[model samples]
Structures are given as C-alpha cells and as structure tokens.
Target chain A: MASTHLKRTSLYDVHRAAGARMVEFGGWEMPVQYAGIVEEHHAVRTAAGLFDVSHMGEVEVFGPGALESVQRLITNDAARLIPGQGLYSPVCLPSGGIIDDLTVFRLTGDRFLFVVNASRTERDFQWIAEHTRAATARDRSADLALLALQGPKAQSILERLTRADLTRLASFHFTDGLEVAGLRCLVARTGYTGEDGFEIACAWDAAPALWSALVEAGRPHGLAPAGLGARDTLRLEAGYMLYGNDIDETATPLEAPLGWTVKFDKVAFIGREALLAQKARGVARKLVGFEMQGRAVPRHGYALQAEGRRIGQVTSGTFGPWIRKSIGMGYVERAYAPPGTPLQVEIRGRLEDARVVKLPFYRRS
Target chain B: MYPKDLRYSSEHEWARAEGGRVRVGITRFAADRLTDVVFVELPAVGAKVTYMQPFGVVESVKAVSDLYSPVSGTVVEVNAALADTPEVVNSDPYGKGWMIVVQPDDLRELEQLMPVEKYLGLIGEPAT
Candidate 1:
C-alpha cells in the first residue's frame, strides 16, 4: 500500500510515541489501536476513553441563507434546531441516494457547522456549497481538531479540567468559546459512543496540549486512549451506521431504515420527492441487526441467506467486545426484518446460523 | 520476546521439536498484532497439515488471520482448550497457546526454519 499520500492528524506523533498501531483509514494515517481493541473498548464502556477524531471533516456555513441551505441539503428539519443545538442527518442526492451522514450544529441564526465523515469531506463540502448561493460554505477541516471523551466517567473527567456546568449542558447542545485546560474550545455534549460524553473541538495546533491534559486528568478515572478499531466496535454495538459500509450512494436512507431521520413535514429538501414516493410505496429491504449462533464471525460482504436463498448481504459485522457476541447489520427483505427471524450467514463457504435481533447490541446503563 | 529454543517461520509460527513430533503455535509478535483473539478454529486430531500452509484460523475482535502450519505432518494432537477460550493465544502465546503437535515427515525440515536471532531480525526487532 502506498501510504505516502495519506494525511496525518495533529496528534499523529503522540499516537506513534504511545506505541499505537497506525493504519490507513479514510485517506488518513490514523491509529487503529493503542493498547488493544477489546481493552480500549471496555474502558469506554466501563470507565472512560479518549479519542482523536480530528480526521473527521468540518464545514462552516454562514450568511443569511445558512438555515435555508441546511434545510435544503439535509433530510432532517434544521429549522427545529435553536442556536447551539445540533442534529444528526443524512445528506442525500436528488435521487435519494445518501451522499454522507453528518451532524449539523447551528452556531447562530446565520452560521452553521457540519461535522462530516473524513472520506466524504470534500464531496460534502462541494455539494453543500453548490446548493447555497446566498450563503458561504467553507471547509475548515484543516483548521480544527476534534476529540471525544466517552464513557460513564466522561463528565467527571471533563469537569475536572473545565469550569463549564456540564450538568446543565443537555444532550445535542454545545458550549462555544469555553476554556478547557486553560485553552479555548468548543465543547459539545455529543459522541458516537452510546454513552454520556463530550466531543471537544479545538484549534488544530492546540490538539496535542488538549490530548495530554485529558490523558493526564483521565488517568485516575481509568481512561484509555482509543483508536479507530475500538471506535468501530463501539459504534457497532450502538447500532450506528458507517458511511462507506452500512450506507453509501448505492443505498438510500429508506433502505438503511433511517426513516426516522427523514422529516417530510419540513420544507422541501434534496431527495424529498424520491423519498416521499418511496415512503408511500414502502421499502423493499430494511437494515436489521443479527446475532451469530455459532462462534464464527460474520464479516462485511458476507451473504445473508434464508431457506437456501440469498436474502441480502452483510454490510457491517464485528465481534462486539462489550456485548460479547458476534453482532452485525445487513439489509434484508422487509419480510425478514422481525427481531426473531432466523438467518444464515455464509462464512468461508460454510453456512452459519444467526438470528435477526433488535438494533443496538449494547446500551450503557 | 523470541525464544531461543524455538524455530520460527516467516509467517510468524513458532515450532518446537519434541522427539519425532513438532509443536506449533503463533509467535508473541503475531498475537500482539492480532490482539484480543475471540475465536479460534483448529483442525482435529489425525488431520493432515502441509508445511507453510494454513491449518486453521485465529480471529480477534477486529481481524481474522490464518494460522499457517510450520511443519507438514499428521496432527497427532490439537489444542482443544482454544475452542472455548481463544484468548490464551494472546495471553500465553508460546506456552499453553500451542496449537497443534504434528509428527513431521522428517525432523530435518526443522533446520529449514530460521533460528530465534534470525527470526527477530526478519521482524525488525533490534538486537537486545
């Protein structure tokens, strides 16, 4: 693999120095693990874990047309969001194909910030910019760094460093220009992990200092430095969709079963017509979670079968560390989408028994 | 931590000669790379294995890798313990983690494998 073209995050040296195993992810040379995937995964579930999510892209849109652009670009109702609130939504093409999944934060009446997937950063920025003539969309991915402190102990650990009243910061709300560890940051009470956590955004060059501060403060709380490997497992257990894997341009939001995210009651948005038509016709296939009956691990691209006939394909699969089961998600025929439906996953040419289960293999207590 | 008494293959399998039979298991370096092995699939007793060929598979939470046989022979014994707790391969890769014991066609084939020092060099471990 020619990794010469891979990008590096601001905390690259810190991860390397800590003996993290680096791998190419979404065009960035990111750490796959620091200690171990399972160990880091449990830490996030039990205690707390810090993550370098700086590889995710950030786009800033501001002007009179900011709300208009956001409402037109995403499937969700951005108008419902007050300033300092964020909502997760899927950016879709006019044909209803998913362009990217991202979170849009309304900074002000006219300014919005979008946190997008790393690989789709450029594409999402171009698409969002082209749709907006009254507003200006600028990609600020290179100028910012994002860190996630997640788990049961996240709030306490973060409180030790920042004076912000975390108890008052509701979910999906952010506090801007907050001083954490003697540095300015934008802290959001949001995270990909299904736990109470914060995603802190800071200047790119200041990331190392923030990381070190969090690591030092988190030591007493049993916090571990997590990587992309643990992040994938964590999100998988949470039943979150990964853009390139669980969703893509080939799969529409309806097929992804992310219908709850689509707001048809709101004004017209991209893919509104196609999605409305599909919603009326009902989706043919729906993404469902399944658990393996045998010890075999179901992997991505594996065939999902029922009665010796192919029903669908596995989009994302993993040995969920916290759940202690082989859990995966796949798009199956709507008839087989029930929680108790029996299914078979083909692994290395051998059919393994599995059962369709409810989404989210694990939840934080 | 390459053991001096064990011979290693380029695939990172360690072999120990015990009379006419050779014990096989992955090295610590390989286990560290795999990390938190969740499941292991091993061949049954009396199964035929070829030298440098995949005998079974080792799966971690994040990855799945093949376990190559270090010697060609009939598998006289297999590690049944790993069927329930495959993480032994990560915790004790060289001792209790031994995968299979094969009665090799010729014990001289063991010499074809690299010595501990050479294997460590191949893995880019600085002399220590």
Candidate 2:
C-alpha cells in the first residue's frame, strides 16, 4: 500500500481489517464507508450505525464563572441551561462571524464539556483559551474520544448494553459516568444526524473496548459501522449546518440563518453588537433550502441565481436519502428567502432550475 | 475483483458484453471502497461515451466520484433502478448494480482493455 499522510483514528486498524475505504476527513483518516455509503446511510436511517468520531474535540470548560464565561463565548444562552442539559451554540469572532458551531453541556455547576467540529478543533480551542486565559477554563483536547451511536434503533441497542436510563434522557441532555459495558463514560443525547442518537465521550484508553462492546451489542439490531460518507448525507438531509462549508469566519450567525442561537438579552459578548445591528437592519443574504430541478446535485461553492444573475452560492447539496431528491441550502437574497420562491443553482457553470423551499428536507416520522 | 468473463479498466470500471451491447458498472473493489452507493448519475440513452472518459457520476454520502467508460460507444441503455435505489450497487455490484449499456464502436477495443487475470492483477487480487 502507498504511504498516505492522513492520521489514523484509534479504530484505524479495525477499519482497515474491515476493508473500509479510508479518506482524509478533517485531518483524520476515517473510513468513508465500511460496506458502502448508501447501505451504511440506510443502516442508520432504518436500523443502527456506529461511528468512530474520535476526531471531534472535547474540551473542559469549568471555573467559578464557567456558565458566565461559556455564555460570553458562544452565541447561545449556555447560562440558562440546566446541569446535564446540552445546548447548541456558535462560538463567534469579534465581527459576529462564526469561529465554530458547537454543543455545550453543563456537566455540573462548575464543569462543562464543549463538543466542537473536528476540522476547527485546534483553532477553536486556541481562540477559547486566549479569551479565557485568566478565567481558568481547561483545554482538555487530548483526553477524550467520541463515538456516535445513530439510527432509528440506536436507543434500544444502547439501552441493552448500558445501565444509563436513556428514556428519561431527553434530547440534548446528558449524564456523566454512565457504565457502558462496564466502562465509565460521558454520554450525550446529541448527534449530527437528525435521527435520535447519542454521542458518547469516553476516555482515550477505553475507546477500543467500548467500541467493540457497542458493535457486539448493536449486532442483533442491524447496527453497522458507518463512515464519514453516511454522516454527511444524514446531516445534510436534516438541514444541519457544517462549520467551514456552510458557515465560517466570513459568515455570521445572523447571515447564516442561525439567528435563534444568539441572545441579545445578555449584556455583552464578542459578537453581540454585530448580531444586534444585523437584527435591526435585516440581513441581506439569508441561508435558505432549495430543491434542484435536475439530477445534477449542487455542491458547496456553486453559485445561486435568481432569474439570470448570480445572487449567492450553495453551501451544501446532496441527494437526500429520506426525501429521495436533490436538495440543498445556500445563502441567497432575502427577497428569494421565503418558501416557494423560484431560484436557480449554477452547477458546473450551467444554470439548473431550483426553488427555495422550507428548511429541513427530512423529519423523522 | 474482476471476473474472468468481464473486461476491466484502470479507472476501476468493468464492462461485460450483454445482448450484443456492453453492460457496465464499477468493480466490487471500487464499490467496497466507495462504501455506500447513495446516488448515481446515470447517462442518458443515445449519449456517446469515450474510452477512459467519464459518462456519469457516483456519489457516496461524503464524496462524489466520476464514472468512466472503458469502451467508446453511444449509450443504448442505463439502469433506471439506481435513480431511487443506489444502494443496489453496494448489495449486488456485479449483478443488478450495472450502470449503463453501450454498443462498442470497436469490438477489438474490448480486447485492448485489461483481461480478467490482468484486471485482478491490477487490483492486486489473485487471478482465478
């Protein structure tokens, strides 16, 4: 085999033994799919799928002003969340542009864990540490491993192996020290997939054991080892925003169609004033969902047009499994933002027919 | 792995003569690596395709790849089943996962492609 520069996951050898086609994703050599992308995608959609998402960054943000400091860093109201409750937030720059979108779980009064995207993990931690240098938030990036158990049947499969009372654990809430096949771990009711799932954060050493156990426990339930391929498709179908692709440093919370995460009620934060100003003036380009008229799927950076002139660009596009059609989201003029508005996506420099539709092309039944 | 009856290309596509036209699909090794066959862009009937050039696209969940034609010809048929059932490629890649059919411009060009043993050799598999 040719020498590849991509770093391997903890489960790299396991994936290699499974004949997985590994690809460089966010600097980690992750299995793009174990069996095939569509099968693994449908596995999670219909049955259960396990993913080794150890590349995601998990940092500890605990101090006397942990809630207050976390609240200041993110666009969302993390101070309002109860202990064990998880809330999605976008960490922003001074200009109200996003650094990364993450989920913060208030593990305790003084301790919280912030789960961030894999690609922006290092820079995000650096930015957070630099902001909170005096505040005492510890950046514990090296000590954690993330595992996602997703699909329709994920809960039942997990319930069998872990003693964690998953039924009472509502979406976005979690408890630490749950025993998974005899290993203590922090399991969160948060996932990138729109389907009901859990993101288990475990000790680095316990990853392989817990992974093996989860796979064994999930076997009877039709759970398969899924890769990055299924993960992106599932998230895209759910209308979830990816940090670098969908929104980034040049994209603000207000312009990215994620205004709900920002709370102006708080006195001040990094991007509060900028978000507030945008709120009052109204955003020019809005993130909206649309369906392409043809089979050609629109990809990231593809231009969005109205009538004939280019207006914006597609941030993400795919053949949504649940919807069984080409659906996408893009930043377009607010004039073309409302559902049912006609638009076009310029794919490969040729205009293809499209229509602005409501967000969320798929909702679990 | 490429079967003895099939002709293979360096691009990982396989073509087999079916009813006087060539039936084509990606190899099992290609499908195994690409992992989920989520969506496939099938070529239109009557469209001309050339050797070593792309005729369509195949997308997994995370990446999109081009589908190449090993033989030059006009497309006579395409697998419409993949329009709504792309996973069939993963499940039955050598059988029902066939992508398109084309009447070869040169029948001798089929021999110019990799033979079954050579195809297996190219993919690093033991020839049957």
Contacts from the true interface found in each model, as a fraction, amount to 0.80, 0.45
Candidate 2 scores a chain A TM-score of 0.96
Top candidate, metric TM-score: 1
What would the per-residue lDDT of candidate 2 be over residues A1-365, giving only the tens digit for each residue? Answer: 33475666677788888778777788778888777666787888899899999888877787777766787798888777888898998999988889999989988887778888888988988888777633566656568888999988989988988876799989998989999889889888888878899999888778888889989989999999988877888898888998888999999988887888888897478899888888899989899999877666788988899977988989998877666778899999888899998888886557889998887888788
Q: Write candidate 1's Cα lDDT for A1-365 as tens digits.
A: 57999999999999999999999999999999999999999999999999999999999999988899999999999999999999999999998999999999999999999999999999999998999879999999999999999999999999999988899999999988999999899999999989899999999999999999999999999999999999999999999999999999878898996888999999999999999998899989999999999677888899999988999999999888888888899999999999999999999888999999988888777
Candidates in order have lDDT scores of 0.93, 0.84
Considering chain A alone, report the TM-score of candidate 1 relative to the true chain A: 0.99
lDDT of 1 at A74: 96
**TM agreement with the true structure for every prediction:** 0.98, 0.91
Among these predicted structures, which one has the highest lDDT?
1
Off by over 4 Å in 1: none
In the order shown, the candidates' DockQ scores are 0.82, 0.45
Q: Give the runs in model 2 whose Cα sits over 4 Å from its true position.
A: A1-5, B17-25, B38-48, B73-105
Q: How far is candidate 2 from the true structure (C-alpha RMSD, Å)?
A: 2.7
Q: Counting only residues 3 or more apart in sequence or on different chains, how many pairs clash (N, Cα, C under 3 Å) in candidate 2? A: 5
